[model samples]
Target: MKVRIGVGHVPVGAHDPAAGLAELADELEAHRVDSVWLSDLASAPHTVDPLIGLAYIAGRTRRLKLGTGVLILPGRDPAVVAMQLAGLAALAPGRVLPTFGIRPAQPADRPAYAVPPGRHAEVFEEALTVVRALLSRPNVTHHGEFFHLDEVSIAPLPAKPLDLWLSGRLPAALDRVGRLADGWLGSNITSGEAEACRVRIERAAADAGREIEPDHYGTYLTVVLDDADERAVGALLDGIRRRRPDGADPRTLVCRGWAAAREEMRRFVDAGLTKFVVRPAAPVTSRRDFLDQFVAELGPMET
Candidate 1:
């Protein structure tokens, strides 16, 4: 398997978004980091809208692949999303990597990602269908429970179709990925769990007569450096505790230092997961420092 590493949204606060993003793009490209990802957070203060941020980053850098660690897909208009992604893909060519999820990560933000009551999965699947149709064909027509379209198409499509990835851990979600998603991007799960999840997705894909690329599987790893302050460490633990499954230790899901993070990636590679988007568990004092340490530790690990 080809192991590739990408950066999740940098947690360090930037006084100037444009300059900061430009610097980030330059550094990541210089380091030859595989990609850069932005998480979706409609209500979070100072968080860049994933799509808009990616568009700006696309203009600032040539080699760094742009990704939405995951943008919430169910609520947005599929046609618009299709066009937006199409635009990004057209601009960046092979560098646009879009992964979507059905719901926002934070509970307080869920309401903003509105879907018809009791039909989230259905809506998500249909919305993806509409998006795929619009991205590839002209004068497309789609009529579904949550969306309706007629003779709608996005022009100047990507030279190659963009691979649509998805994130989810539940059985139903894995099934959905196998049936519909081009790949999977999991988070907050152990290597054992990730291995099992990959098997499940592949099985479901086989049952559905589909096959996800082996190297397309990836996950977001939250790492807390040894030098992280108490508040940062405590906040990471507390958030994970609240989100952890019953009886599961929150500590088991996080990497404690660069060494541990590297070891964890090796474990994941052994489990057949090849792509990674590693995010600092808490905000860093310096994005450049964190990235420098990140490359020193994990750069050689990529194959």
Candidate 2:
């Protein structure tokens, strides 16, 4: 399988969205990165909408593929998303890949965007099916538990079908990827965990009477880099600490030094992951530096 390398969104905690994205696009184009992705955080302050941000970047850069890391599917109506995506693809032909995922909505965000506690995955599947059909056909009518469309068609169709990816951490989600998604994207998972997840997805595909070829499996890793000693690295580590999972230490999850980080990526690649999206742990000042170091270490492998 071919290995693909991509740069993901810088955590929106401390950066100015417009300036940060502008700089990021320039850096990615300079390094010849494969694809550029942005995150969708429903309630985060200063976070740009992923689709709008990608459209802005699309106009600025020529060759880089644009994608959403994972758009929280349950947050918006599928028909609305389909229209938005179709329009974006019309503007940037064959360049946008829409990645969708099911996320547990926060308590504070529930009133604004509500899905029953256990029903997000089901809703996501139904929504994706509706959207995919509408994008492909001229006039489509569908009735599903979550969505209903009658003779709907998306105009200015894309040159090719969009590459759809699913992201999650549950076995059920892996099964959904096998049956519905064109690729899988994971977060904060170890290499061993990734391999196990891939196995489950392949098994689910087989069980569903689908053939599994070279699946596009991608993982996100937190990386910290400093030209000096660990103190500079520690600052970046602190940023990650703020976002650590409920019971885990941030230090345990980050790849610190350049050498160690490269080895960590190697392990994931060896485990059958064909793509990687690296999330830098540093602030804006250090983000470019870490990106440069990462490209120097990993770019040749992709080439």
Candidate 3:
């Protein structure tokens, strides 16, 4: 099996978007990571807009693909997102991948987004269809259940139509990915869960008489340097516990001690994952430090 490695950013409690992203982008390019992924969170502090951040990084880097780990689709109009992604792709050319996701319900006070309950699969499928049509056609009009487009055309068409990805955990979402998306993007899921999801997606595509190649499967994992002091490890574990008290054992989830982490990577490789987006644990003061350690550990495993 082949495996690719990438890097992800978590804008948790960030205080300075410009400084943080500048540092992170430099580290990612320096490490030669395949992609740099940003998350979309309504509550994140010091969070730079994902597309703007990617554009900034694009000007600074030469090769790293700029991507969104999951851009919640329901929160924004599909046409608006299509235009933004298409513009970004035109500016970056072969360096942008827009990964769209269906968000769960939000409070009434929150922005008005229309993803009906239990209908994320249907909504996402329809939304993708509309977005793709608008991007690929000069004068596109559509009247869908959730969205309506009237003779719209985005100018300076992307060097190529943006590669779309879907993010979700349910079987319905997996099936939708098989039918509509260029790839599947997710996080905090174990290899076992991912493998099962992959099976569903492949089967769904086969049933549709679509011989689509397996959509790219990508997951974000927290990385911790092994040679670091016990205090460092403790801080990392504590952060994980704070974020997910009910999730897997924090220690097990953290890829600590380079040798042990490499072993874990091997397991994921065996499970057919194409890419690993490594994000450092909390209290990670030095982005380069963690990335350097990851490169040292991952170098031997590279195909």
Leading candidate by lDDT: 1
lDDT of each: 0.87, 0.76, 0.72
Tens digit per residue, CA lDDT, model 1, 1-303 = 789999987766423344467677777888778899988988776677899989988897889999998999998999999999999998898999999998887888889887878888888999999988888887799888888987887889778888999999899999989999899999889999999999999999999999999999999998987767668678778777776657578789999888889889999999999999999877777888988998989989888
Residue 226 in model 2: lDDT: 51
Question: Candidate 2's residue-wise lDDT over 17-105, tens digit each?
Answer: 65678878887888888888887766656668788899888888888888888787785888888888898888778878788867632
Q: List pairs with backbone clashes in candidate 2.
A: none
Model 1 pairs in collision: none
Ranking of all candidate structures by their lDDT, best first: 1, 2, 3
Tens-place lDDT per residue, model 3, 151-190, is 8898767756666877876787788888787777766566
Name the weakest run of 10 consecutive residues (lDDT summed) in model 3. 104-113
TM-score for candidate 1, please give it.
0.96
Off by over 4 Å in 2: 11-13, 104-112, 227-252, 286-288
Of 1 and 2, the candidate ahead on lDDT is: 1
Candidate 2 RMSD to the real structure: 3.2
Q: What is the Cα-based lDDT of residue 69 in candidate 3?
A: 75
Runs of candidate 1 with Cα error greater than 4 angstroms are: 13-19
